[model samples]
Target: MTMTSPVALTERQCTLIARALAEPRRYQILKEIAGQGGSVACACMQQKHEVTPATLSHHMKELENAGLIEIVREGKFATLVLKRETLDAYLRELASL
Candidate 1:
């Protein structure tokens, strides 16, 4: 799939991305998903981070809204996958600064 280039991002999108990453817990959540190299179950993340279900849901929503991750829902379970292209684009934008 084609990826969005961060250089082409609108101001609002940039703000969303920044806000999504501003919290330490959210950053850690992203790192954990990335480290998995594929989709990670929400249950796994909850155990790894020791976060409450409600808190995890909030963090996942932020990541999804920012285009930083994709969530696949199967039954009552959800799995998270990092949007590597989005991250690459963000890095590229940073390097341009």
Candidate 2:
């Protein structure tokens, strides 16, 4: 599959990305997802931060909306994975700016 460039993200998506990076814990969450060898479970993401489940859910939503993370549901379980290429492209865009 062809990967999408971060420059393709819309204004709303860019806002979501900025919001996600603004929170330290959310930033850590992204790191953890990247470090994980396999697809991370959404439930597992909660264990990485000290925040409440509600807050974790909110962060997940922001990351998803930002297109930085992709969620796939298998039966009752949801997996979260970092879109590293997209993230790299985003950082590259910022670097060029």
Q: Per-residue lDDT for 1-97 in model 2, tens only? A: 9985445555566677888889887788888888886368988876667788898888888888788888898898889988876687678766767
> Residue 9's C-alpha lDDT in candidate 2?
57
Error of 2 at 56 (Å): 0.9
* Cα-based lDDT at residue 30, candidate 2: 86
lDDT of all the models against the reference?
0.86, 0.79
User: Quick one: best lDDT, which candidate?
Assistant: 1
Model 2 CA lDDT for position 35: 88
Give all TM-scores, in the order shown.
0.87, 0.79
Question: What total of clashing residue pairs does each candidate reach?
Answer: 0, 0
What clash count does candidate 2 reach? 0
N/CA/C clash count, model 1:
0
List runs of model 1 lying over 4 Å from the truth.
1-7
